[model samples]
Target: MSLKITDECINCDVCEPECPNGAISQGPDIYVIDPNMCTECVGHYDTPQCMEVCPVDCIITGVEESREVLEERYRIISGQKVA
Candidate 1:
């Protein structure tokens, strides 16, 4: 599954650059994760890099997607899939 930044986020501006999928962005109040583009670093790393670097631990997994689905999502986002 992808990750979401909670209200606990300190807005430290660290998670954005750590996301390999470019899913994290500055929201109105805190950093937010884009579910459509997030792959939990499936194609880039073994674990979620955003969560790794978040100081407040506000980044948490969301929308329980299977590994196969996450992998497919990454492929689609990375333009690895053919029509």
Candidate 2:
């Protein structure tokens, strides 16, 4: 599933660079993940990179998406259509 940054995010900017898909971006206060670009790192890594580098462990799964959905998202981001 797609990950979401929680309120625990300190706006540390650590997670931003970790996202390979460039899904993570600076929000009004915390980091936000663009669902359209979020693939849970399926195409690039074994695990989510943002969650890996988040100091506060604020990143969590199950944010309005499922694994199948995320996989489709990855395909879309990689210029492939979900079949």
Candidate 3:
């Protein structure tokens, strides 16, 4: 699942930089995660870096996606697609 920053977020500005895929961004309010670019850090790290560094634990999983889906996103983002 792609991690999302909830309304509970304190806007601490830590999670944005921690996302390896650059999926997290500062929204009009709190941070937002782009599911299209999110791989849950499956290919880049053992766990989502945003979730790791969030000070308030406001990051939560959303729209549960299988590992296959996450890995496919990683492959495409990394330019590893067979084409």
Candidate 3: segments with Cα more than 4 A from true spot: none
lDDT of 3 by residue, 1-83 (tens): 47778899988989888888899888998889998999999899999898888878998889888988899899999889633
Q: How far is each candidate from the true structure, as Cα RMSD in Å?
A: 1.5, 1.8, 1.4
Instruction: Give lDDT tens digits, candidate 1, residues 1-83.
Output: 46778899999998899888888889998888989999999989988888888777888877788989899998899999734
Each prediction's number of clashing residue pairs: 0, 0, 0
Better of 2 and 3 by TM-score: 3
Kindly report the root-mean-square deviation of model 3 from the true structure over all alpha carbons: 1.4
Model 3 lDDT at residue 47 = 91
Clashes counted in candidate 3 amount to: 0
What lDDT score goes with residue 78 in model 3? 86
* Global CA lDDT computed for model 2: 0.84
lDDT of each: 0.86, 0.84, 0.88
- Once superposed on the true structure, which residue ranges of model 2 sit more than 4 Å away at CA? none
Candidate 2 worst ten-residue window by lDDT: 62-71
- Which residue ranges in model 1 land beyond 4 Å of their true spot? none
